[model samples]
Target: MVGAFHGHAHNRRCQLDWHPMYIDGTGHMEGEGCEHVFSASNKLARSTRHASVFHRHQTIEEHFAFWDTDKYAALSNFLRNHYREALTSIHTLTAELSVYPRLEWELAREADNQALTTIPVGDLNQISAALSQARIRVDSAYAKLQNAEALTAHVEMQLQVEERWAIGDDTYNKYKQETSLCRYCVALDELECLVVMHLFELSKLSLSGTGYKLRQQIGKALQRRSEAIQNALSCYNVQAAALDPPRPSLS
Candidate 1:
């Protein structure tokens, strides 16, 4: 089974076949074994860069030996936390499923019923019936002329004010500023979810068991997402500048 983190990066169609969520007997393993060790040992590269092959090998072996001891020492605490997390996830999912316990056939039938209701009629029978009633009301002597005149005036006012408010108008500009502020807020929210959450996850990641190629892929993803972050930031700043009072732009 693919590791949870790598599996998430796969295409949605690919996930159905490979993701741990869809796979049985995978347990709760993140499959990040020894990645934490590899990340911490990056500093060793500087010291070993000039060393002989024997010394380099010795340093790596020593580091792994220490890492294994530390990992074993914390094994109990790790297992305890994972158990709690698994229980919490199971309970939450169970509650949600209970609230909306729908079967596949039920959902399919509901969708089919909705599709049938939406099918358009080719005739104007409904429209003709409505027009006939409207004509009768208009011909009635007791027809409320005052109410009709008020409605007409209201519609004219709307056309003059709401419909005619062009780009340069104050009302239009105010709404435009509001829209930009909304976009800025949405962008900030996305950044928080993507950057902050990913950073926390990466802090606990280990790449040792995942291989060098996987490490390179993760590195490239980091670089690529940095560009996306920059673009979002740029968009935020642009929107900020368009605000009514002009929001303070990010550095």
Candidate 2:
């Protein structure tokens, strides 16, 4: 290809520029007039890439129908943002923690490690401060995830109950209508507050720590939240037991 272009260059002096172009690990000579050739190659490459055909959709419902149910299993908006934020904090913390090891901290243990590197390495107190901040972010994220999980469980229970009620015989339907003072509804409200509190706490957070101690804070909060969820579940279970027992779940 180079020889052909070089030979062509000798005679065809139509004000063309010559440059080396790499195509699929092979070298080729390109010039001004060779643009058509390059353009053709690009078109061919694009055609190959887009060769597979996909179904077209007429509506959003159609789009959702085409997608599998598992796509809906992603973390919902509330959880997704918090999850990503926590992940970012974790990433930064890991990078911060690894900096010393990555830059040979052991070799310069006695030296002013922070002063030696462009990236600031904190002293013990500063490291503790960064860790406290990381813990706050992590705790907030964990609480949000817990809240989401609880709410999802509540939603599933409500849906299941509705489905069972709707499918039951006329006698069961009459009982369901007559019995509206269920504790499960209150449980749902509690779950809603849990989710809302998670969101509210996130807004209240600043870059610095929440001034709360870090030791087992996430564990303690999760324990308390878990108790709340369990209390709700217990109430819901009572409601379920009162009903003509939920239908056997399909495998």
Indicate which candidate wins on TM-score.
Answer: 1
TM-score of each: 0.39, 0.22
Task: Encode model 1's per-residue lDDT on 1-251: one tens digit a residue.
Answer: 66676777876556655666555566666666556566889979856855789999999999889888998999999999989998976864554445434574356445444533554445698667656655664564244466466555665664574455687999888888778889878877876766874684365347446656656656666777788778878877887787778888885
Alpha carbon lDDT of residue 247, candidate 1? 80
Compared with the true structure, model 1 gives a TM-score of: 0.39
For each candidate in the order shown, give its overall lDDT on alpha carbons.
0.68, 0.49
Whole-model lDDT, model 1: 0.68
Off by over 4 Å in 1: 97-251
lDDT of 2 at 61: 37
